[model samples]
Target: MLLEVKDLHASIGGKEILKGLSLTIKAGEVHAIMGPNGSGKSTLAQILAGREGYEVTAGSVRYNGVNLLDLEPEGRAQAGLFLGFQYPVEIPGVNNVYLLKAALNARQKAAGKPEIDAVSFMRLVKEKAALMEMDQSFLSRSVNEGFSGGEKKRNEIFQMAVLEPTLAILDETDSGLDIDALKVVANGVNLQRRDDRSVLLITHYQRLLDYIEPDYVHVLANGKIIHSGDKSLALQLEAEGYDALMAKAAG
Candidate 1:
């Protein structure tokens, strides 16, 4: 398994959020986690990304057979774990290409590899930027500064593509995107799919799935996965709504 989250129970500020949530992702699999607001979907992503503040009261997370909970956020990144934030932050005065090059070099250095040459790094970034359909001017701008919502989301995927993480956890990446931007972002994700890469897409709407097409679809409710099925499950949820599934799970 690329990522295994077993019976995860977490809380924030003394309030329970994740309750016995178990999930597994193998190499090359795309898993879509859909849920209503406050369902702990984002919480699960946060915990997996090694974000602090939320306490992991119980359960274990194994990534590539290692204890993921023991690693720091940067450690996780160096180990090929990437998280695409719902809201990408802006870093003023930091060049986007420069930041990405530094991040890539850091990961390579941690793996005992030599830093990439400037010429090769530029070529890589330009290729990835083209894959994301981003203009060349974006490379000169500050990271995510003055970008629109859709642009930020695209940049997140762009970073993921350049880094080539073994596992990616995207939290509500399609939250505020238009149809055109959504297609562009989804295409970028689809093009980056590799046999050694796994994706965990946390989303609320099935429309994103229409473009990306997950191998597995899971419905998370009240901090638990109440249902799991194939891509058709997303269509079912879209047609019938989460109410019926939530009621059935509760019953």
Candidate 2:
């Protein structure tokens, strides 16, 4: 298994958000979790990324057969665990290119590799930026500051492209994006697909799945996975909605 989340339970401010959510992702698979608001999808992503403030009351999360929940946030990144945020934050006064270089170096150092020289790193970034249809000017601008919603989401995908994580969790990445921007972000994600990489997408709408088709689809409700099936389940949910899915699961 590339990622194993077994009987995971998490809470925040004394409120339980995840209730024994178990999921396993093998190499080269794309798994998606779809749910309505307050279904604990984002919480699962945050806990996996080692975000603080959430208490892991129970469960074991192993990545590559090693304990993952014990690692720090940066450690998780170095270990190739990536989280694409629903809302990419703005960091004023931080140049995007410089910030990305620092991030890449950190990962490289963790892997016992020498830091990439400026020329080589820039060349790589330019190639990826072109692939994502990002303007060169955005590279010199402050990180996400004054960027439109679509731009921020695109930047998140761009960061994902640069980092090249082993397992990626995209939490509502399709939110707030128009059709054109959504396609761009989806294309960026699609281009990253590989046999050794695994992706977990948490989304509410089925539209995004149309572009980045997942191998499996799971339905999360009230902090638990109520149903699991193939990709066609997303289309079913889109047509019938969560209420019907919940009813089917209830039966």
Candidate 3:
């Protein structure tokens, strides 16, 4: 198992958001989490990425057999864990490629590896940019400073591609994208999928699954996963909505 969350209970500002949530993701598997608003999907992703402001009240999260909750956010990133935020932040003066290079070097340094050379780094970035169908000029601009919603989301995936994280948690990456942009982002994700990488996609809609099919689809309700099935489950939820299946789970 790449990640294991057992009976996780977490809260923010004394209010519980994740209650008895459990999940496991093995290497190379893609899992999609779907739920209504306020179901704690993003909370789960945030906690896994070692975000602050959320307290773990009970239970445990183990990543690659390590006590994941004990690691700091930067530690988690260096350990090959990546989180793509629902809203990508804008850094006004930091060049996009510069940030990615620094991040990559940091991770490499943590692993006792040499920093990637300039030539190799540029080659890799350009290759990934082409994969995301991004203009080369965008790489030189400040990170997400003036990017559209779709462009920001695609840039997050582009960062994921370059970093080549072992486990990626994408929180609503497909939320505001049009069909064309969605396909571009999905394609970028698909091309990066490998036997050594795992992806956890938190989404509210089923349309994303149409492009990047997951091995498992999980329904989260009231802070816990109420049900799980294959890709067909997403189609079911799309067709019938959450009420019917959630009702069945309640029974």
Candidate 4:
């Protein structure tokens, strides 16, 4: 397994959100996590990304055979974990290009590789931007400052392209996007798919799945995965809704 969570338990603000959640993802697979509101979907993503304030009361998370919980946020990134936030942060004074360059170089340095020069970095940014249909001028703008919802999501995928993480976790990436923007974001994600890379898509709606089809879909409810199946499961959920799943779980 490329990633594994065993009997996972996590909480925030003294309230338990995830209780004994377990999951496993191997290389070259895409896993979609769909759930109703407050199902601990985002919390799972945050925990995997090493976000502070989420207390892990029990269980273990292993990535590439290393204890993922032991690593800090930066350490997790350097270890090839990337998370696309539901709400991308705005860095008022930071140029988007500069931020990407710095992040790429940092990851490279951590992996014992030489840093990419300005020329090579710019070339990469241009290529990735074109793939995402992003405007060239946007690279010079401040990081996510004043960006529209679609722009911010596309920018996040652009960063993912440059960083080339082994495992990418997208937390509600399709939430605020319109149909067109959703297609663009999904196209960008599809272009980045490789035989060795994996994606964990956390979403509430099944619309996003129409574009970026997953190998497996898991239904998360009450902080645990109540059901899991192939891509067909998503369509079923869309048709029958969470109430059906809830009723089934109750029985």
Candidate 5:
């Protein structure tokens, strides 16, 4: 397994959100987590990313045989874990290209690799932007500053491409995107899929699954994955709604 979460429990400010949740993801696989509002779907992503204020009181998380809980956010990133936020943060006065270069350099240094210079780095940036159909001008702008919903999501994928993490977790990346933008973002994600990479997509709607085609779909409720199945489960949930699943979970 590339990623493992065993009986994980987490809370924020003394409010428990995840209770005894567990999951395992292997390389080359895509997993989609679906749930209704307030079902702790986002909490699991946040916990995996090592976001602040989410206290894990129980269970263990291992990434490639390393203790994930012991690593800080930056450590996780350096160890090849990427989390695409639902709301990409805008850092004023920081050019997107420069930010990406710095992030790449940080990871490289941690891995004892030589830093990529300007010329080589721009070559990579251009190649990835073209794959996503993003305009070159967007790279010169501040990180996600003044970007549209779709643009921000694409930017997140752009960062993922540059980072090339072993595991990527996307949190509601398709929430506000229209059909066109969603397709573009999904295209970028699909392009990054490889035999050695893994993706965990957290979403409330099935629209994204239509494009991304997850290998597994897990239904989460009240902090636990109450049900899990193949892609057909997502289609079934979209058709039948969560009421039946919720009832089954409660019973």
Candidate 6:
């Protein structure tokens, strides 16, 4: 298994968000999690990303054979875990190239590798940016500064491409994107799929699955995964509505 969550329970401000949730993702598998709002989908992603203030009241999460909860956020990133936030933050005054270099260098240092030289680094940046269809002018701008909703999501996928994480968790990345922008973001994600890479996509709609074609689809409700199936499950959810399935699970 590339990632495992066993009976995971998490709480914020004494309010429990995750209730004995369990999940597993094997290598090369794409798992899409669909749930309505407040289903703890984002909470699960945040816990895996090592976001602070969420208390893990019980259970465990293991990633690449290491105790994931033990590592800090940066440590997790250096270890090849990436989280694409639902809301990408803006960092004024930090150009994209500068930030990318810093992040890449940090990973290199963690792995006892030398920092990439400027020429080689720029070459790499250009290659990845082009892969995501990012314009050159966008690379010099402050990270996510003044970007539209779709552009921010595109930038997130661009970062994912550059980072090449072993496990990439995307939380509601399709929200607020128009069809054209959605296809662009989906294409970037599709290009990143590899036999050694795994993706955990948290989404509300089945449209993204039309492009990414996840190997597994899981339905989350009330902090627990109520059902699990293949890509067909997503279609079923889209057709039958979550009310019926969740009601079935609740029963």
Q: Any runs in candidate 2 off by more than 4 Å, and if so which?
A: none
Clashing pairs in 5: none
Model 2 lDDT, full chain set: 0.94
lDDT of residue 209 for candidate 5: 97
lDDT of 3 by residue, 174-202 (tens): 99999999999999999999999999999
Give the alpha carbon lDDT tens digit for every residue of 1-251 in model 4. Answer: 89999989999999999998999999999999999999999999999999999999999999999999999999999989999999999999999998888888888998899999888888999999999999999999999999999999999999999889999999999989999999999999999999899999999999999999999999999999999999999999999999999889879
| 3 against 5, candidate with superior lDDT | 3
Model 3 weakest lDDT span, ten residues long: 43-52
Q: Across residues 187-234, which tens digit of lDDT does each residue of candidate 6 receive?
A: 999999999999999999999899889999999998899899999999
Runs with alpha carbons beyond 4 Å of true place in candidate 1: none
Candidate 3 residue pairs that clash:
none
| Residue 97, candidate 5: alpha-carbon lDDT | 93
Ten-residue stretch with the least lDDT total in model 6:
123-132
C-alpha local distance difference test of each model:
0.95, 0.94, 0.95, 0.95, 0.94, 0.94
lDDT of 2 by residue, 1-251 (tens): 89988899899999999999999999999999999999999999999999899999999999998899889999999999899999898999999999889989999999899999999999989988998999999999999999999999999999999889999999999999999999999999999999999999999999999999999999999888999999999999999999998887788
Runs with alpha carbons beyond 4 Å of true place in candidate 5: none
lDDT score of residue 47 within candidate 6: 94
Residue 178 of model 4: what lDDT? 94
Candidate 6 Cα outliers beyond 4 Å, as residue runs? none
lDDT of 1 by residue, 1-251 (tens): 88889999999999999999999999999999999999999999999999999999999999999999999998999999999999999999999998988899999999999999999999999999999999999989999999999999999999999999999999999999999999999999999988999999999999999999899999999999999999999999999999999999999
